[model samples]
Target: MLLSLRGVSKSFGAVHALQDVDLDVLAGKVTALVGDNGAGKSTLVKTVAGTWQPTSGEIFWKDQRTSIRTPRDADALGIATVYQDLALCDNLDIVQNMFLGHERLRFRLLDENAMERAARGTLAELSVTTVRSVRQLVASLSGGQRQSVAVARAVMRDAQLVIMDEPTAALGVSQTAQVLALIRTLADRGIGVLLISHNLNDVFSVADRIAVLYLGRLVHSGDVAGYTPQRVVEIITTGTLATAAT
Candidate 1:
């Protein structure tokens, strides 16, 4: 397992965001987290990304327990999160966006050539071919192309685990397919992927494992092949397995 959460919980004053939640993300596989609104999915992601500290429980990276108290701590551990916003500057070009905060320096100055070369190399490694050039502005790219850039940026930072939130939420059919294929490619490259999506079709298409969260607790988690879409919906809505209810 690349990442594991055991008995993790988080609270905000009077409200409990997560309670005794357990989850695992394996290298070279996609683990899809599915749930309705207020199901604690966001809370769990925030906790893992170091945006919020867990109230109780342990986080294990590579089977060794560790603490992730801040986003820097998570990044140092090779955990990168791409939120729904993508966080890319519209005015900046691809190379600038990729190395926004971690620009390479040459003689006390930003190395534009080196940065561009590295960005192109990383995109090539990920087999991203939509954007015409690395110098293209982010606003000019399509929805899927923008997603590819965001993911490539994460990979360039040496992220071993990439957590993506609603990566295809606003994309059309073709764009959604493109992003989903990109996700599979990422897993094939041995990077653990945690995908949070509300789309069941997307989940079934890419997830090796599906975990359903209800309210603030995990209700079901199993291989994707073990449950049908209807069964998954039942689990998400009622917090019970179909067989158990039957």
Candidate 2:
């Protein structure tokens, strides 16, 4: 496994956000984390991304025990997270936005040419061709183009594990399809992906495994091929798979 969360738990003041959540992401596989509102999906993702440390339990990377106490720590360890907002600077061009904080320098001078070349190469590797130029401002790109930029940026940093939150949310049919294809490309390249989404159709389309959380606890986890939509809906609402028998 590239990433694993074992018996992880977290709480915020009076509310318990996660309880003994166990999840695994293997190379070349897309794992979907799904749940209703307040079902601890965000909490779990944050814990793994190092936004919040788990109050209990452990996180393992490549089967070695590790502590991700900071976002920088997670990034250094090859864990990249793309949140709903994508955290892109609209004013910056594609290459600049990709290497925003981790710019490559040659003798104290920013290597703009190197960065631009790398950005273009990465996008090409992902088969992203919608953007006419890497010099184009982010504000001018379409929704799918922006998402591809974010994903390409993450992969460019040698990300072994990528966590995406609502990647296709609020996207049009064509835009969503584009992002979904990029996701598959990521998995095909042997990168572990943890996808958080509410759309079961999208999940079924790309995920190899599905993990459901209910009221801060993981209730069901299995291969997508083994569970029906109705059974998954039941697990999300009731924290049980009893409906699978029917």
Candidate 3:
């Protein structure tokens, strides 16, 4: 496994956001995390992304116990999160946005040419060629192109585990397909991916495994091949797998 959450739990004041959640994400596989609103999906992803520290339990990376205190710590460990917002600066170009905080430097000077070249190479690796040029402003690119840029930025950082929240939430048919293909490509390249999405159609099409969270707890987890859409839906609504087994 590339990453594992063992007995992970978190609380905010008197409310529990997560309760004893156990999840494993393997390298080169897409693990889909599905849950309704307030099912602790976002909390779990936040914990994994180092946005919030777990109140209890442990996180392991490559079988070694690890504690991710901040987002930078997670990034250092090769874990990158692309939330629903995508965090791209619309005013900046692809290369500039990609290397925003971590710009390349040479002899105490910012290396714009080197950064652009690296950004181009990363995008090519993901087979993303729809953009006219990396110099174009992010605000002008299509939705799929913007998403592609965000993903390329993560890849450029040598991310081993990429966590995406609602990647296709508001995209058009073709754009959604494009983003989904990029996700599959990431898994094919030996990257562990945790995808949080409500669209079961997209989930079933791309995920290798499914983990369902309900009321702050992980109620069910298994291979996607063993569960049907109706069964998974039952589990999601009732927080039980008994109906799914039938």
Best-matching candidate per lDDT: 1
Better of 1 and 2 by lDDT: 1
Quote the lDDT for 39 in model 1.
97
* Candidate 1 residue pairs in backbone clash: none
lDDT string, candidate 3, 85-199, tens digits? 9999999999999998999999989999999999999999998988999999999998888889989899999999999999999799999999999999999999999999999
Clashing residue pairs for model 2: none
For all candidates, the clash counts are 0, 0, 0
Cand. 3 TM to true fold: 0.98
Q: Which stretches of candidate 1 lie over 4 Å from their true place?
A: none
Candidate 1, lDDT over the whole model: 0.95
Candidate 2 C-alpha lDDT tens digits along 165-199: 99999799999999999999999999999999999
Give the worst 10-residue stretch by lDDT in candidate 3.
237-246
Q: Quote model 1's TM-score.
A: 0.98
Per-candidate RMSD, Å: 1.2, 1.1, 1.0
